[model samples]
Target chain A: MAPILEARHLSKRFRIPSVKRSTVREHVLGMLRPSSTEELVVLDDVSFSVERGETLGIMGRNGCGKSTLLKILSGIYMPDTGEVIARGPITPILELGVGWNPELDAIDNILLLGSVMGMSLKELRQATDEILAFAELERFANMKLQHYSSGMASRLAYAVAFRAVREILILDEIFAVGDAGFRERCESRFRELHSSGHTAIVVSHDPRTIKTFCDRALLVDRGHVVVQGDGLTVADAYTALLTHEPAAAAPTAALPEAVPAS
Target chain B: MADAPTRRHHWGGLVWTLVRTDFKARYHGTVGGFVWALLKPFTMFLVLLGVFSFIFASDPVYKRNLLLGLFLWDFFAEGTKVGIISMHQKGYLLTKTRFPSWIVVVTSASNAVITLAVFTVAIVGFLALTGRTPSPVELVLYLAYLVAALLIVAGISLAGSVLFLRYRDLNQVWDVVTQAGFFVAPIIYPLNILPERFHFYLYLWPPTAIIQFSRAVLVQHDIPTLRAHLMLLGMTAVVFTAGAAIYRRFAPRAVEYI
Candidate 1:
């Protein structure tokens, strides 16, 4: 079967104005002088594909455009010169409880965020109890989220998002939060989804996670794909790249092209 | 493709949730709660009625007309004002997910619609107390005008919200426009009070046509001409289309600025 998701020659560039003018008065004064902009290429001709049910891990250092790549794939940000073809709905857990209203209780927030994630009202309503149970916040389900601890809120967000996951899930730092026990539950749940043939593209800095959880992985450095291979190989490359001097030449030509899934 | 219905269902559910949550969050922890929604236009109506009654003492239906005018004007003013800032208020949602951007503006403006619905009940009570209930035909005509007013607000808001991301001072500019609009739209006094020649100019503003025609049908028991109806429809179409066009041009880049 063809890949469930394909990104072809994706490139994104952002222009940063030398002087930010966000007011009408400042804009009026800005016309007197020609403003200059510095262009930043966040992603450069990056190409990749994910087969159905496969987990693709993206390993990168800070500011290497990992999050930007995920955002583009999830349709949160449009690529400047390329396209993303998704065969099915994409549930992007870029941030948990994105539309959550702190004034609302857990049930209301589940309804809000779940719908925002493309779940129907009936599905969300039926799954509300299950979500609350998963988060272990059944007792606090009626309480306002603002009054809850940050960890509790994070749990609720994860519970709600997991319930609302659709065809393809794009997760950013899914294991970055929660206690060890809660992280264990998340990992098991993720494994269950993976076994059930839910395609996912997970971005993380931890090589161990990529090695253990991902079937295939890509190492990215400064807007270029450094290498793509089986999980362990790419993870080792990421670790080795970290120790090398920043000024050392990147092994861009030596790496093989990202093989599109057949 | 088979899940198309599910996608529609989700968007509908999302819009409803956002609107409902907005209504609750605005009134949460308040002493008056939802009552404040009613009190705002009613209080303004009372103040305006008191002052305007002295000026138009000769007209018998002045009270009803003034109340209706205020309610309609309040909806427009409140809707656009809230709608303009809605994108920024919901910036977190836009940046974190992929959904229709227009939902943010519509949900923010919908609070005004709910307030107007509640105000409609109050209007009926006031009309009954004054022994001047509108005919069914008049109510229908008035409803059509209310829809037109809403479209005008939606149009302005659609453009305003996107523009607001770049021009942070847009709300202040809108405040000035609405402040001037309050008097220019014939909210406190009837349009006839102005010269007949200037009436055409006043009608050029969409709200002016909406408020005046609404008052003409519901309070004055007068049916507007077919030409006037067409004019209102044309103006609404133009405003809404222009706003949608501007939004389409700019909204794609809105997330960057936000």
Candidate 2:
């Protein structure tokens, strides 16, 4: 089968005005002066694809455009130059608890965030008990989110998001939080998803996660893909790059291009 | 392209959830809960009625007309007022997820819609208490004009929501506009109090036309001319189309500015 998702030469550039003009008076006065804008290229001709039932890991330094690339793939940001072709619906957990209202209780938040993640109300209502159990917040289900600890909130966010996953899941730094037991549960759930043939694209800084969970991985530096190989090899390359230079420098010499999945 | 299915699947549920959450949050802690929605317009109506009663008391239908006009204006004013700030208030959701941006504006205006519905029922009740029941034809005509008013609100909101993201002071500007509009739209006084030439200019504003047309049909028992009906429809179409176009063009880049 053809790749489930593909990014063809995707590029994104954001224009930063020299001075912020957020009011009508400033905007009108701005017309009298010469306009100055600086364009920042967040993504530069990046290309990749994910096959059915495959887990792809994107490892990049801070501000290397991993999030931007994921935003484009998830349809949150429009690319300036290229296009993303997605054969399946994409559920992006770009951040946990994105729409969570602290004023609402756990059940209310599950309904709100679940719908935001593309789950129907019926499905959310049916799984509310299961979600609370998963998050280990059954006792605090009716308590307002404001009263819950940050960890509890993260767990609820993850539980609802996990249940709302569709044909393709795009997660950004999902494992950066949560306790040891919750992390273990998430790993087992991810394993179950992988075995069940759910395609996913995960972005993380941890090489162990990429090596242990990803089928293939790409190392990105300064908006360009530096290398693509098996999980372990690419993970090792990332670790070496990090050790050599804490801050990402110029892109290294060309390495192997992405190998098409058989 | 690939996200279309997910968006389409979640559109209705998402809109409903947002609107419901908004209502709950606004009223959840209050003792009266949903009663607050009705109480706002009614209190405003009572206050305005007392303040202007002596000036317009000569007119037999002044009370009913004032209540009706207040409800219509409240919908337009409150809807656009909240709708304009909705994009900025919901900016977090926009940046973090992928859904049609217009849903935010629609959800914001929904509170006004509900308030208007409840206020309309109150108006009918007040009419009955005063021993002047509106005819079915008049009621239907009034509803049509209310819908036209809603269209105008939706149009303003669509453009305002996005524009407000760029211009932070838009909400304050809208507040001043709405405050000025209450007097300009013939809500408290009869249209006949103004000169005939000024009447035409007033009718040019969509809200004036809506309020006048509704008063004519429902309270004054006077049917408006077909030309008046066509004018309201034309104005509604223009405002709604332009708003939708502006929203479509600017909403995509709204997140960048926000």
Candidate 3:
């Protein structure tokens, strides 16, 4: 099958300015001196692809470009030297409730958040009751979001997002939100999406989630993908790396096929 | 899907929705709600009335002119103040979504417009109570000046909002500038009190021209000279164009800083 999404030679660098050139005097003085900026390479020549109806798990240690890769794939950030060819509409739940207004009521936020995530107004209006019911927020629909707890807010966000899922979805640590019950609901939703043949790029640190849900996976470290293969190999490598165990300690020897290094 | 709704919608509906939410959210928890919007200008009017009413007790028209001037000045001052920080205030929207950034600034300024509209009703009611109804042409001229003032303020606000993102000191500088502007513009005092040489400077600042031209037509029942009208239009165009240019150049990259 043809790939649904492909990122080629993806790289991104964030610049850290050492000087404060806010004032006119400092601005001129800084121009006279050598430029003082340190570049942090967050993603370095990392490339990957996800086929149609595929679940690709992205695992990495903190600050290892997992979220940045997701952002680049979602077109929130322009890669310094790379291209992402995506075949279908992509919904990125990078940060749940990122665009929510705390002062607005739950129903109003539903409209705002749904439209912002690319759902049509008609669709949102039609799905309002279902979304509110899914979040268990029907009672608080008229109340402002500020009155809702963080977990409740995320639940509402997830509900809206779940209703708006299309052919391609990029979830960056979204499954970690809410309580155990909501997480279970989310897991079931993931299963539903899986059965429906939706292509997904899921970034999570949970080994079980990867092992159970992902068809294939990639483990990134320090802006580079170090392992790529079926879910078990990549999950085991990630677990072994986290536990300070060597590659041989991860049942790599017992497995006849070795995971490919990306 | 790769063909997601990246295409910008006809954003009029969205902008209006945002504006309504912004306006409503501000007063959601407050006891006064929208009355707070009117409270500031009315309180200022009372204080100014106490200070200047005695001095111009013999001339009721001077008192009316001063109040009108204060109302217009308040609109310009409050609009630009909110507008300059509008982009920063909506930083979440900017970094998270790909909507047009200028609408953020416009929405912020529109909050001031809502307050101005409320005060206008009071002013119109007051004029009717005092049996001094403005001619339809005068009202039209005054409305024109009011619009020019809003555009000029919005233009300056757009430029300031973008530049202020990179330069944190601008808020302090703007506070000083607007305070200085409050004194220079004919708000509490009439333009006739200033020396002839400064009249040119006043005309150059679009807000000042707007305040004076509006007062001339609405309060004094006098038509503005053709030169005065031309000056307001010219300054409005220049400031608006400059603001749009600044916004276009810096707004796209502004999300990175936020």
Candidate 4:
């Protein structure tokens, strides 16, 4: 199948300035002085694509640039050098509750968040009932988001994503939201999305969801994709790397593409 | 969705929508709620007028005219003060989605306009009550002042909003300027009363010219000569041009900082 999204040679580098202070006084006086600089290469020549109706997962440890890749793909942050082509209406659920207003009630936040997501007020009203019901937040719909537990906010956020007419769903480790009961609900909603042949890109550390929900996986070490092919092989490679032993040099030995040209 | 071709230059409507959301959120809680946008400024005008006229042995003509100038100046000062926080206030929206960055500045400036609309009623009503009826020409002059003032304030505020996102020192400086400007911008003093040497430079402040124009049309009942109107309008355009150039160039970087 033709790819719905493609990223090529994407690289993001960030400068973190530091002071080369000669004395403690200079370090303290840097507030009134200038400083030197350092740099971090967050994503180096990373590239991938997602086919229509396919679920792809990104698995990495913290600070492994998984979130940075997601941000670049979502168009939140432009890469230092690269380009992205998205085919359809892409919804990037990066940190589900980021759009919420603490002072506004759940209902008001629903409208506000939905509006930013490109839904009109009239259209949001139509979807409101389904969203609230799906979130199981009937009673707390009028409560301020700050008052709700983090889990409750997650449920509402999920409801918003599921109800939308999404062509590409970008998930940033959303499975860890809410309690066990809410997790079960999230699993069902996710399954419902996948079974309908929907397109999704999930960035997560959780092994189970990546294995169960995603048809393929990309394992990132530092800023490079060390392994990319099938889900099980990628998962095993990722786990092995974390175990401190050398990961399999060829995680996807079975896939013909994994073998070096002979 | 497939189409013949989608235009890339359709962010104006989206910017407008965000501006509307900002106006709603601004006056969300109050005694009269959003209506106070008009009432609060007018109340300040009346109280200032009362203090100057009733307590101080000030001339009635200058006092009333000065009140008119204060009304116009208040709009400019308060508009920019609130606008300086436009990007910072909407960090939640800015950090998440990547829409046109100018939406925050436009929204904040437009919200100030909503309050200015309220202050306007107080201005006209107070003028009518004071028995200073305006001729049609004078009425046109008042509107011209409002147009110029809004343009200048919107421009300055847009630039200021983006700047305030990075350096917060400007926030305190702005408050002090407005506090001092309320007295210095010919809001409470008469430019005609000052020497002719200061008169030309007094118009250097676009807002001062706007406030003086509003008073000339409303309280003085004089149809400012065409030259006066043209001068004010030209300066208004320049102020807006500078503001727009600064905002468009630098406002996009604000999202990165946020």
- Across B1-258, the per-residue lDDT of candidate 1 in tens digits comes to 111213444688989888888887888735479788778878998998878899999998888788888888889999999999989988877876677899888789878998898878777667768788888888888889888988999999999999999999999999999999998998888788788999988888778998889888877789999998999999999999999999999887688788
Candidate 1: stretches off by over 4 Å: A96-99, A245-262, B1-9, B29-32, B128-131
Report lDDT per candidate: 0.83, 0.82, 0.79, 0.72
What lDDT tens digits, residue by residue, belong to model 3 across residues A54-118?
99999988988898888778766667777888877677776665557877898888876666566
Best by DockQ: 2
When summed lDDT is taken over every stretch of 10 residues in candidate 4 chain B, the lowest stretch is: B1-10
Model 3 clash tally? 5
Cα lDDT of model 3 by residue, B122-217, tens digit: 887888788878889988887898789888988989999988888766777788888988887877876776789989977666667887787788
Better of 1 and 3 by lDDT: 1
State the lDDT of candidate 2 residue by residue for B1-258, as single tens digits. 344652347567788888888888888945488787777777988998888898887888888788878878888888999889988887767876677789888788887888888777877787778887889898999889888888898899999999998898888888998898888899888889888989878877778998888888878889899987998899999999999999999987687677
Decoy 2 TM-score against native: 0.93
- TM-scores, in order shown? 0.93, 0.93, 0.84, 0.85
In the range A1-262, model 1's lDDT, one tens digit per residue, is 8788888888777776779889887899889888776667778888998998999999988988899899888777778877787877788877664445677888888887788788889999999999998888999998998898878888887887788887788888878778898898889999998999898898888888898899999988878887899999888888888888453246543222333211
First chain TM-score in every candidate? 0.91, 0.90, 0.89, 0.87
**What DockQ score does model 4 reach against the true complex?**
0.25
Query: How good is the docking of model 3, by CAPRI class?
Result: incorrect
Q: For candidate 1, what is the total of clashing residue pairs?
A: 0
Kindly list the per-residue Cα lDDT of model 2 for residues A1-262, writing each as its tens digit. 8998999988776666678788887888888886666666667778889999999999988987899888888888777778888888787877665556788888888887788777888888899999998888999998998888878887887787778887788888867768888898888888888899899999999998998999998988877888888898778878878887543344653332332211
* Model 2 DockQ class: medium
